[model samples]
Target: MKTDNSALARRLGLYFVMLWFSIGGIGHFVATGTFASIVPPYLSDPYALVYVSGAFELLGVIGLMILRTRRIAGIGLFLLTIAVTPANVQMWLHPELYPIMPQWVYLLRLFAQVGLLACIWWSTRPAPKAEGIRNGPQFP
Candidate 1:
């Protein structure tokens, strides 16, 4: 038996994204206060922002699972990750404010977010169609 490693990797990546967002989306509702605390003060209505982002996260997960919707979902999720950079930045900028972990951990999260974006972009991309000469029906 032979294995197609690229296909395997892509499948794993897609599942990772789905699971990550699914849990995070649920967390947004279940632990609204904890998620809301991460929101930067500059933003208005922390709760609303949290809810909206959470809803988007869940939507993205659904879109990711369906082949027809994967592309749009990847795009939306990529932008969402970018959109939340500021909150991550704030966490890094002032460790005193958010004591959830050490300063290094917050900084590591910023880096991890970049990796996450890359994963979403690469994994959700449509697989290339196989190429071969037609067995029949030849034409210009």
Candidate 2:
């Protein structure tokens, strides 16, 4: 019998996403000074705020990794991504404030957020049933 690879795929996908988000959250802590520069000028205490954001990211990633809470975690990740978009926009608009990064890098980072948002949405989507597939050789 063929192994049910769908479940395996889902698990692996979740692992990658969990690892990605969790590390990104940790990066906030490790690179607090650098990360704070990207916060919009209007915001106060950027450093402290980022630490709180990192905590949420860590929690969301952990929740997604565990089966029982995957759905809720996925939802949280989706919302978090949306929530953080303002900082991304700030980075893109004011490259001068983030002098450490090149303009092109900032632009690409903005684009990457779109992909990350899509990936989080896709990773959390409910898995389709195995029977939903119609197996057959294609003929043309």
Candidate 3:
């Protein structure tokens, strides 16, 4: 039996992302008002949207944990991030609305989402080919 470091690293990355989202989802319920406050003014029913996003986050975490569901989960979470971009934008445009954090933090969060998407894609992608002889080569 042999261990593949790349595969192990991907799995660890997946788990780390899952844990991060799980906590965020739970926070939606625990601090509904805080999450709702970030919703863009144009969106109606901020509280409901917050809870709905929380549900999807939990679902995405479950999907990421299962081997068969990882791809879908990655896709879903990626879309979810896109969907929530409006809120991020709102925060950036109206820093006065969310006084708890400085204006610059919201800008960084937009970039962070891109990194998170890349991590999710890398972690959920198909396993790499095993190290060995190639189709037309044989050594020793």
Candidate 4:
């Protein structure tokens, strides 16, 4: 019996995102107060927004785990990444706000965000069609 490598890759990719976002969701839950503190000052109520965003992340991760909803989940995650860019920019702009973590840690987080965005992009990308000599009727 031969195994389809693409299928395996897809499963691995799905599992990777599932685990990655799950951990992020947990971190948000565990450090909601800290994360709220890190929210940009422009937000009217950073604490409420942080928790709401955390809930969305947790739900998105759970949705991504199911095959039927994988595409939607990927889309949601992609939007979430884009939506959070302000925070990334704010962190880079004001490192002192994240004093609990080293400067390098915040930079690493930004890079990791890029990686996650790439992964989500790869996962939701349409599979390429197989190309082979046509087995249909041909001119003699």
Candidate 5:
């Protein structure tokens, strides 16, 4: 009996993504100022961007829940993650500006971003249809 480990993994990943984004999305509204503070100096309307990104994060969570939309959601999330990199970079580069966060946190945030992307991609991937024949031709 072959184990459907991929399904299990996908489920777990989905849960993680859902919870992670749900909280982050809600944070945009909960502490809008805090989230906006990290925006790069060059960006205009930091508050709007923060709120928009938060909305997308919540949308991604919803997309991840439905099987039909999972792949596209993963792609959106991947791009969204990339889009937010600049803010993370800004934070890392301007540690003096964000004294509340420890130096290690900047590094960890960058690393965690990569992991989040991987999880979103892996979890949203559709399982191969020919499972029984995945190993080889089925022998009757």
Candidate 6:
């Protein structure tokens, strides 16, 4: 019997990413103030941006579960991660601002974001073409 471990891993990774974002999206609504606080002060209407990002996270989670929309979802999430980087950086720069969280946690989160991006890309990428398969019909 042949087993495709990579496929299985990718499926698991996709599920994990979906769940992570789903919870995060819901948290935006549940803890709106906390999320808003993290937003850089330079941005206008931080609360509105928090909610908007939350909605996008939820939408991306749904889109990720569907094969037809996975690519778009992945791209959206990748962009979202980028969009939120500034907030993470802000937090890192001012550890005293978030007294409850230590500096190391923020540093770890920065690294985790990179891993999350890699997972999104790996899980949502289109399947590779099989060997010898091309534009023409194939025979067994």
What Cα-based lDDT does every candidate model obtain?
0.82, 0.75, 0.81, 0.71, 0.81, 0.82
Clashing pairs in 6: none
Which ranges in model 5 have alpha carbons more than 4 Å from their true place?
1-3, 130-140
lDDT of 4 by residue, 38-105 (tens): 77888878877777788888899877656566678788988988888788878877888777767777
lDDT of 3 by residue, 12-102 (tens): 7777778878998899999999989999988999999999999999999998767677778878988898899999999989999889899
Clashes by residue pair, model 4: none
Query: lDDT of candidate 2?
Result: 0.75
Worst 10 residues of 4 by lDDT: 131-140
Candidate 5 lDDT tens digits, 58-121? 9998887766677788789889989999999899888899999887899799999999989877
Write the residue-wise lDDT of candidate 2 on 5-95 in tens digits. Answer: 6645555666667888889899989999877877887888999889988999999977775666777888898888888888988877888
Global Cα RMSD, each model: 6.6, 6.7, 6.2, 7.9, 5.5, 5.2
Runs of candidate 4 exceeding 4 Å displacement: 129-140
CA lDDT for candidate 5: 0.81
Range of the 10 consecutive residues with the lowest summed lDDT in candidate 2: 131-140
Quick one: how many clashes does candidate 2 have? 0
What are the clashing pairs of model 1?
none
User: What are the models' TM-scores?
Assistant: 0.89, 0.81, 0.87, 0.78, 0.87, 0.89
- Give, for candidate 3, the lowest lDDT window spanning 10 residues: 131-140
By lDDT, rank the candidates, best first.
Answer: 6, 1, 5, 3, 2, 4
Clashing pairs in 3: none
Model 6 lDDT per residue over 4-100, tens place: 5665576677888888899999999999999999998999998999999999999999988677788888899989988999999988888999988
Clashing residue pair totals per candidate (backbone < 3 A): 0, 0, 0, 0, 0, 0
